[model samples]
Target: MPIGDINVPIVGKNVVIAVLVQSHILFAAFIIGAVLIAATSEYMGMVTKQPRYERFARNLARFVVLLFASGAALAITFVLALVTLFPVFFSYLQNIFFWVFLVEAFMFLGQIIIVYAWYNVWDKLAYRKNLHVVFGFIAGFFGLMAMTMIDAVASYMLTPAEAPATDVARTFLNQTMVPLNMHRFVGNFGYAGFLIAGWAGFRYLKSTREDDRAYYDWMGHWGIIWGFGFTMLQPVIGYGYMKGIRESAPDAFDRIMLDNAFTFNLLMIWLTVLAVAATGYFVHKLRFSVRPMPFLRKLAIGGLAFTALFSVLNLIPADGHIATGITFLGGEETQIPLGGMYPWKYIGLIGLMLVGFFVVALYLRASASGFHWGNASRWSQFALIACSVTIVFTMVTMGYTRESARRVDNDPGYLIYKCITLDQKVVSENCPAVSDGVNTISGREAG
Candidate 1:
């Protein structure tokens, strides 16, 4: 039976598939980032002889081990939903990416085994700390390999290589592949870090014991450092990613950067929230620093001011047209001042990165000197929570912006951007003539 002939109920097939995939992505991305962070923490514990680091690493590894099953289950369900709802599209994708899928599956299996082994042998290999740390790193490596394999497929869908699809190397190394991979690789760390910070903040608030409060307070500080540090690198990487999209898929780029600019603006708003909240946390925490450096605090406050200023610049729209049915200033679309992507937005992004670096540097200096951990204000903890919540919305908005770019003007759109239609039809002359030695349409040996 034709895959298109199968119709989903009132909610629609696209919505069902989207929900499953997005949910699965949230889990998968977290696991990948968490594994790396756990491994790093364990190594730090070994070198610094810090029990807190060890405790955090052990708990995180255990959490990853427990969470693995849920992530895997959701991944399987997403695949099943995709195959059932979009069989033809899935079939074509599978044919082109068979080896990639095979490699990803093995990587996933290897990650699971190593992660469990690493967690289970925590005490058994206490004497052999170096070897146990290697196991954790190995698990992280496997997860990253799996992520890389999947990224090739995702990037290709947006900016497919001009070469024949059967050209495996070219297909895998599509224009956007490396940038997309780097973006996600960095994003995972930031996302996981913010969540950890938020969790620690909540625990700190709930704890009655001084020791517990101190531990959670330190954890929150450590987590936010990782989160904010990695997030600073994203703007440049994301710009390169978007540049590739513009060069390869102009129509999609126009849809995202111009026609549907609101989504991109929303993304910037979330980013602004992240910067402001994280910087605010840093500035507040500096006030409780053991050494009491008023100069550093003032610097951080200045950095926060500049960060907010630049973020407002980024939030400005290129034009008054916000959405399909929306317009600003008396329902007439018009160009807005200081809103162009070239000079204004680029300047804003650079400014944000610079200010972010300055603030982080100041915060880290205070960290090296140490802070009165349990004495952090409630408002600072709330700032961490705000960052965590904003990051979730940022991820969702990013995904939506990227995918919606392909659906310009509510069109059926191409699943593979001009190569394969959403209905699973091959629409491009550049598409492979045959798949698995059979004609794609006729299902017979290619003449």
Candidate 2:
């Protein structure tokens, strides 16, 4: 067959699926974060005599359980999609972390048992509240650990290390594993807080009873405090993450960061500023809940506006060159192209990110629309489904973006040629060494 006659795989479709699947993982991450906060708050509430905190904890825990189940289902779909589309990548991962999957399976089963017990026995076992709480904590903790180990195995692939001679333990226990775990853990906490704060605050507004409103407002603010604070520290973890990646694989780090490291670093700088500004807004709104704050509205609106613009500019153009569109008057390469200006992209994306939260906040703000107790609106249920769909699709898109950059012909560009076969024909896709007429792809390739 002519080199061009053989079609390249449908790169975009698989990537789109990958992005959606990724969203599922993120949903799970948020739930894990919520579980920790909810469980921790209640654990402390037990000793502190602060009934409001305990109340907040219970409500929040219920939310976490619901979201986690939804995320788990979504995650299952994501895995199945990966297995179907990218058998090679999946097989590669399974081989390296073979045992961990079994362990994760057990951990998941254990989690279900504990969570159901915890939720079901809220009133049945008052005497063993402490013990019951421990069960939930253990369950959440293991669930997180199992996920984290899997993540470690993944990050290791992106940043592999010098394997010592002999078995040298499992390859999954790579260097960046610990740092990556910490980073992910902190992210989980922060994200959970962000989600719950608005949720609780909304309910507090609708509450007729002064006591209920006060307690809920307090809870909402507290969740934000934890979430926003943890989120603010993301840069620190990110910095360490960069350093670790740099130390481990300077070449890979260089490629990831690019030749213009300082310029690329600008993305984080602007993102931090936006995040801090957002955090201040987060705190101020919750703190000054005596009345609605227009400033918060502007923050959301402005943020969303920026996000839309940024996403437009930064989105993977159907054709992959942000640089081509923005050229200097003269080709000395003196001036930065639009997206070429790093860090500034954050201003755009962070802006777009506001859309979801902004709507969520508004819904919560409309407290006087007459609310019912027990199982919210069909709209709420739909919103959950929407979140799941958006997350999974975006994850898929991300995968496409990454894979398109694979080394083809050892040169750049979509159709660049990589290597020649023994027969001297140009190879369009990457090929393995012809060792004993057997190929060794990192993952098990589908026939």
Candidate 3:
């Protein structure tokens, strides 16, 4: 039975919707994690009477709040996209995770109210500062819980356990559920922490007052410290996630990772080194707090040196080992594995983004005199615009990846059965009598 029987839409409407929904995900994450962290820090400072921490927290929280508003709005748009584009998927998901999504919605509303109150009463609620602080934490906690609930559904979709055939709820609560949510939570913090540090550094560069600049420098150091800590923890979480996937749905995980055996290994190797290097450099830069940490420069260089080395390794051919077990692009769709091992360019794209972040951080710290409005030094503006674009585009790609990976017409064990295969001979035998894959030709019922 060939799958050419069903007239599925070209490019698949589900894929488009998934991309839109996924793209909105990162923004929601920004609001929930980084912004929440900063907000909590502000409240903590207020209660402790730590003016230095309080000031940093205040400014950082403001920035995070602005970003969070945009993120929250886009998250609503994501839900809309889900209904508009992937109607079938939306239905299945709602039915499967009905209670979870409903709870998430309530949590979102609670978070919003908390955010509004927390921000508005910064001064008004000064008398009972502890109460206000608790409000912000409430929002942050609910937001985190909502995200965690949703992750179970996402993970279930990727790793649909055999249990679903018996009990759908059991399938939704599979092995990947817990680890994936935790992995993603830490990832959000790690990415956001770095941005906050860069923001602090930019402030330091902009201010003329020595004390103000010093305060910003210290804040920037703190941000990096948080980022570095999370960065280290990220790998552990990821390993657990991958391990869960391997244990539960080895085939799907293998299709994505093992098929790109060399590229995946090489990238992992370099990123491991990069994470360690970044952590060491981050600590060194903080220890001195003078100007770029001259003594610790070697460690930064060493870290990057390894990053570059692995970048080259990633470009190497893995044909020696995983050749027959990999996939490729732009070639004949021969045997599924034998073509090649290229898991698209998404991973390398992430690497490029990290490089861009560092470059922008450098420019942000450079003096205003160094900036030329026009004819010279345009890269700074370019980096900023690029960063913004990357955020949006990456969101879209993630959505697309989620749906596209479903492989509606691929192997068995998954029920993305939108397309139905038909037997041409059987069709020829009975023409208009057939009713898709469930029924037979000659107006007879299929068993």
Q: Number of clashing residue pairs in every model? A: 0, 20, 5
lDDT of candidate model 2 versus the reference: 0.52
The candidate 3 region of ten consecutive residues with least summed lDDT is 368-377
Off by over 4 Å in 1: 330-332, 428-447
Model 3 earns a TM-score of: 0.66
* Candidate 1 lDDT tens digits, 293-352: 999999999999999999999998877677778887743357788988889999999999
Cα RMSD for predicted model 3: 10.0
Candidate 3, superposed: residue stretches over 4 Å from native: 1-15, 43-48, 164-169, 206-212, 260-280, 283-405, 408-447
lDDT at 247, model 3: 64
In Å, residue 63's CA in model 1 sits off its true spot by 1.2
Which numbered prediction scores highest in TM-score against the true structure? 1
Q: What local lDDT score does residue 430 receive in model 1, on the 0 to 100 scale?
A: 40
Error of 2 at 9 (Å): 9.7
lDDT of 3 by residue, 103-199 (tens): 8889888877777767777788778877877777787898898888888777766664444323546645666788878876876675566556556
lDDT of 2 by residue, 1-447 (tens): 432222226665445565665667667776677777877887877887777667776776677677767877876877776565555445545655667677887877777777767777777766777886786698688778777766656555544433411122434565577777787788677666655655664665567786676665555546655655565455557668767766654544544444333323334333433343333343334323445556655665564455445445543221222232433445334444454434545444444345435533553463323122222333332332232233233333333322332322224322111222212343322322112243322111211
**Model 2: which ten-residue window has the lowest total lDDT?**
414-423
lDDT of each: 0.87, 0.52, 0.53
The per-prediction CA RMSD against the true structure, in angstroms, equals: 3.5, 9.8, 10.0
Model 3 has an lDDT value of 0.53
